[model samples]
Target: MTIPSVKTILYATSLSNHTRGVFQHAIDLANVYQAKLIMLHVLKPLSDSNIMAIQSYLSEKDIQKIQNVANQETKNTMKQRLADFYQDEMAGKNLPEIEQIVVKGLSRYAIVEQANKLNADIIVMGSHNKFGRSSATTRKVIKHSGRAVFVVPTDG
Candidate 1:
């Protein structure tokens, strides 16, 4: 089948230093295709067991306090860093509409679901190239995405 003209691209990131290269690649692809860029950050949800375990080690009040602090810190960090990156990318270029999405769920599944929902032409993400577990997770995402995925090597 002929490759369709990409009109929208999803750039999935974890706001990690290593993922910077992947964001750059996404910007380049968006520029080339003149496509809208969507930046996605998935925050893995805290399981009930995990919450209960934390509560067991600390008072309920203390646990709530810690959880709130952690969540706020994460949100602030992601927001500031992503804002700076996006601003820099669009400084003097005719950038397409860029949307930032932050959601709580499984990264692989959430990312794939968002891509499908947004009708993204392509999904670009950074890979740590970890074997075994990580590879398996990536494979699952690729299999279920039903869209083009470009995995950029973080080490390279």
Candidate 2:
């Protein structure tokens, strides 16, 4: 059988400090294959208090304005951080096109959904390998993504 070449790689991250160790694998693979890297960070929905505050004190336009600014700032920070990580890990060599994404939702569902939406050739992520084999999110994505999943063992 002929093996397929990877075109796009989705690196689903938890944005945890420990996961930094495992993130290197994604950068290495992307460099080796020269594939586009989609860096994704999924955040759980904001606290009830925050949501209530938005509804109570903020108009629709005001909410949008505030949230949009927050979102853009978050995007910029994530992108810069990931870029720095890649650069530091690889010594600024063989960098790939990296797209940073942030969204609020259930991690398992959001990750698989994004992978499918991006038509990613592979999904790479870091897991603590807690529950027998991997974390809950890792297992769910492996089962539901319908794409190749690479789970890097992080220093939990």
**Who wins the TM-score comparison?**
2
| Model 2 residue 18 lDDT score | 71
State the C-alpha lDDT per candidate.
0.79, 0.81
lDDT of 1 by residue, 84-118 (tens): 87687657766567777777788889989999899
Off by over 4 Å in 2: 47-50, 129-134
1-156: candidate 2 lDDT, tens digit per residue = 977899999988766677776567887888888899998987777788988988898888998897778778778877777767856776747778888888778899999999988999999987774233458888889889888998887766
Candidate 2, position 16, lDDT:
65
Clashing pairs in 1: none
Please report the TM-score between candidate 2 and the true structure: 0.84
Instruction: Return the clash pairs for model 2, or none.
Output: none
Output the TM-score of candidate 1. Answer: 0.74
Q: What lDDT is obtained when candidate 1 is compared to the true structure?
A: 0.79
Q: Which whole-number lDDT from 0 to 100 does residue 119 have in model 2?
A: 93
